[model samples]
Target: MIFVVTPKIPHFLHFTYGSRPSFSSIHSKNSATSLASTLKSISSSPSLISHGQQLHCFILKSGLNFDVFIQNSLINMYSKTGMFSCARSIFESSPTLDCASFNIIISGYLKNGRLGDAYKLFEKMPLRDCISYTTMIIGFAQNECYEDALALFREMRLLGVVPNEVTMQSVLPAYARADGTRINAMLLHGLVAKLGLDMNVVAWNVMLNGYVKGGLVDLARDLFDEIPGKSTYSWSTMIGGYLQVGRLVEALALYCEMRRTDSRPNEVMLIHIVSTCAQATRLLEGRQCHALALKMGMNFHDFMQATLIHLYAACQQVELAYLLFQEGTKDDIPCWNALIAGLMRNGIVNEAARLFSIMPQRNVLSWSSMISGYAQNGKHRLAIEVFHEMVGKGFKPDETTMVSVFSAISGLCALKEGRWAHQFIRCNSIPINDKLSTAIIGMYAKCGSIDSALEVFDQIRDKARIVNPWNAIIYGLAMHGKAEASLRIFADLQSRKIKPDSITLYGILSACCHAGLVEEGKSHFRSMTAEYGLEPNHKHYRCMVDLLGRAGRLNEAEELVQNMPMEADAVTWSTLLAACKMYENIDVGERAARNLARVEPSYGPGRIALSNLYADAGRWNDAFLVRRAMHNENLARSLDCGVSRLCNALDLT
Candidate 1:
């Protein structure tokens, strides 16, 4: 707001006044005392801007305002109080500025997430050092401007500045965040190697994590082996890596090695191992780890407790899962869901329902767990009841519950119940997508209604959803004595570019044997191996034997059994024995029965088929001995006796 004055007249007036009356030295002491008092008062009430303005006027009157300590104190007070404009004024007015002063303002701006202002001040600073650059880069990365962070790092390097380990550690994860086949990750690792930053344990862990998250497990392992010494994080990364790829046994071994090496497994490592144990279903190992975690005093952590609940449930130790659930202090929704799911998994649906009802809070997962438990337990009515409650409570069902409930109703063969559920789904406009339709088809098939099942099957055209439905429909048709219809379904599945699984082939092959279509069955079996790349397991081989045996080709069936790469299980040998019964080949039947007995002496189906073969051959003594052996083994013969039928009579009123 000042204007320029004529220099000659101003200089003449200033010289005359300055020479005539110099102020007494006594005034200097008063000025000094006043400025000191003012600085002290401002410092005490520094937060008040109005007081600061009055103090500014007093300092201008005292003419002792340039005290560096006072200026710095004012800057600190304003910056601390978030009065950046006032803080910047004090900073700009200072004639003597040091790195410390610059750092204070820069840190203030950075802390407030005002990176633009921070960068501007950083550029204007006369001194650029490691701490300055580190602060800026950290702010950039923290703000998620990773590219800018890297660019600043490059700028630091070009200035012939050597970055310290902290510098490398801050920016390394930025490369991980940028995606290009993980090239940035690899480049960063190479930079670390070239810079010899391995002595920095933090840097090494970051690189190890980069490799892990980038899916370079081999590279991660290589880096792991080369580490001068590994820490808990290093062990966790490797263990987690093995786990991510389902190499559960390897993960276990590493955990053991880690324990042997005396690396104190912290809470995180324990959680990872617990999850791995759950996946591996190693209940005993999980218990051991649980004990270790308790000894280590990490038992109170909510994450560990949740994992313990899941592990116990997966091991089918629902009692232990409940015990943990009871002891847990933090009962999150997931914790409740895990306990409920565990109970359901162990077929303790009644207990699951009890727990679910008492849950303080219920989300979709809790409801789904209860529904799934009832459905799997063949309590289809209860499952549907839960679904209705879910809808009535305004909790919309998810896909998992839909699929699970549909499957349960189908398994129970409750045709009326299934139809009612179907109608409800339709009225509510629930998607009758591939999964729902497949479940319906499975339901009809279970009820021995092939035509209705096939009608539902015809509607699914999506290849992804078609294959599974086709497999279900085929199995249903084959079990109902309509083998030809099963084979035809399989053919249609194959024609639509939807590859069938061994299960589909298993059904079709059995159907082919039942219908005496040996050639077609053989062709389909071959296609399973050649086209689908499916290894013919014992089930497939058993179906092949049935296919051959039904055609009166006993020798081919025997050859198929003998040529099995693995030992034929009870089902495989039993299928061959059944063929012997149908073809009346007593000698082969006896051999199959003996093999079957060796495989599983107590299986009722095998024992009955063998005993009947001896009876049909008039080997009454052998048949009596077989029955005696069965009785001695305490294997009861399943009563395939006639089941009484109920006749429904309609009365016209």
Candidate 2:
């Protein structure tokens, strides 16, 4: 006989036992017994709450409301339906209560997250059982009060309450969360084996998960392999462990092994595989995983879709990424950001901008991606434009955004914009970290504000001033001809025990070149390999050549070029050629010109330098020959403006 509750009258009781039992027919002991039996049956099913309610009304009408069994059943029903207030009312109004009564109400409170109330009522209980302790232990773990949960489990043990598999499941996660609790978890594992609970699949999965979250991937893998029959969750947990420690290859191998087994990968496992593919940049494997996802009918999951988008983008497969984005729901901001960032990465700035314009909504990530994309592509003006648009639309830029905007300003040499960015950083009280400080220093230096650059450098705390910012400051001072100050800063950097990198030595060499400190330049250049153990690259060699050649020591410069450990690239030879042009040394100039032309015949700057060298030395025929060669090679048009300026300066025309 089916029993149902009518929603038209919430308080009224109706029964469909064989035939509908009317209110008039429900006034007997047998009828009341039947009604109470139906309520007990329906109470466990939360969907039958209305029917349970109607049964409760009938129980009251039959004078069974004061019955302990019926009232506890009602409490259980209300708690299961998430109607905690009604459950509490029944518990408080009960005249006769048992340990079952306390356990029911306490479990309700625990399930409802009323931990304080659960603890209070637990304290007031006259009798406690293993179920009582287990409920509270699980409650504490569920609420993330790991310490309290462990403390209570110890207390339960002290009271001689033997823990079952459920108890181990609850307490194991607590151990995972607390620090220095791995030993306790291991001890619990031993206890579980001793208690013959190790065969319980749920208990084993919990132990494996505990080890994973505790960052013990090796132990987790060991435990995982020991499991006689692993579940999908077991595979997922171990895979996540490997990913956490950057063991992407192992993660993928395990995932592939899982696929070989009968265990079907769920949405979570697919997401992890996709993420592993992204991190490893394995496009082929990622595509196979995508195909598997489609085959398994798990592509509808929003998170999995987002992860796949990121995976394709990371592989530099922008078209595939955009196709995925269009195929999925576009409302997810992360998916949008991933596509935009991917487009920017492939240098498709216009497409990225177009996508950014039509996004349904914009977040900090959206704006930051566009700004960074524009800046990275050398569209500094567009980058600044997006920054302003972001601000005018009331989006507060984050530290990353500020850094990109400052970089754009530095590129454009827009002092006004640079000053505004600095002010914005100051007004917002943004913490000046190394990256931002370096950007600020570079911006001020490029904008011809050496004092502001120095001020920014001075404001950096000693501990926060790393090598990069020091390089910026030294390079800035040297570029503006503050050679002595630049060298002083380098000395300060050394005294502070900050090690100089290749770029730092390059800045010092540049300072020496500008100040004509040929001896200092030579000492620092030799020290690059001697004291610092830095193998000087071509840039370092070029700087040295420039320093010596500028001082009219063209012979020494030529010798340095010939004996360089690395091949002197075109730039190094071009530096010597320019120095020759400056001092009108035809011998070294011709040699430099020959090497430059050989290294890069298509490079216009090298040809122009050679032309200028001939013009300066009154070798008109030789100069014309170089010019005609440039014209014959179709290089003159590209360099016409610079060559025109050089001819006008030297009255060659």
Q: In model 1, what lDDT does residue 620 have?
A: 80
Cα distance off (Å), candidate 1, residue 352: 2.9
Which ten residues in a row are the worst by lDDT in model 2? 1-10
RMSD of 2: 13.9
Q: TM-scores, in order shown?
A: 0.54, 0.55
Candidate 2 local lDDT, 594-628, one digit each (tens):
67655665557876777787888888977887677
List runs of model 1 lying over 4 Å from the truth: 1-245, 249-276, 284-304, 392-394, 429-437, 449-452, 455-459, 463-467, 480-499, 526-533, 603-653
**Candidate 1 local lDDT, 518-561, one digit each (tens):** 89889988988799999998888978887788788988888889
User: What's the lDDT for all of these models?
Assistant: 0.73, 0.81
As a whole number from 0 to 100, the lDDT of residue 246 in candidate 2 is 79
- Which residue pairs of candidate 2 clash? none
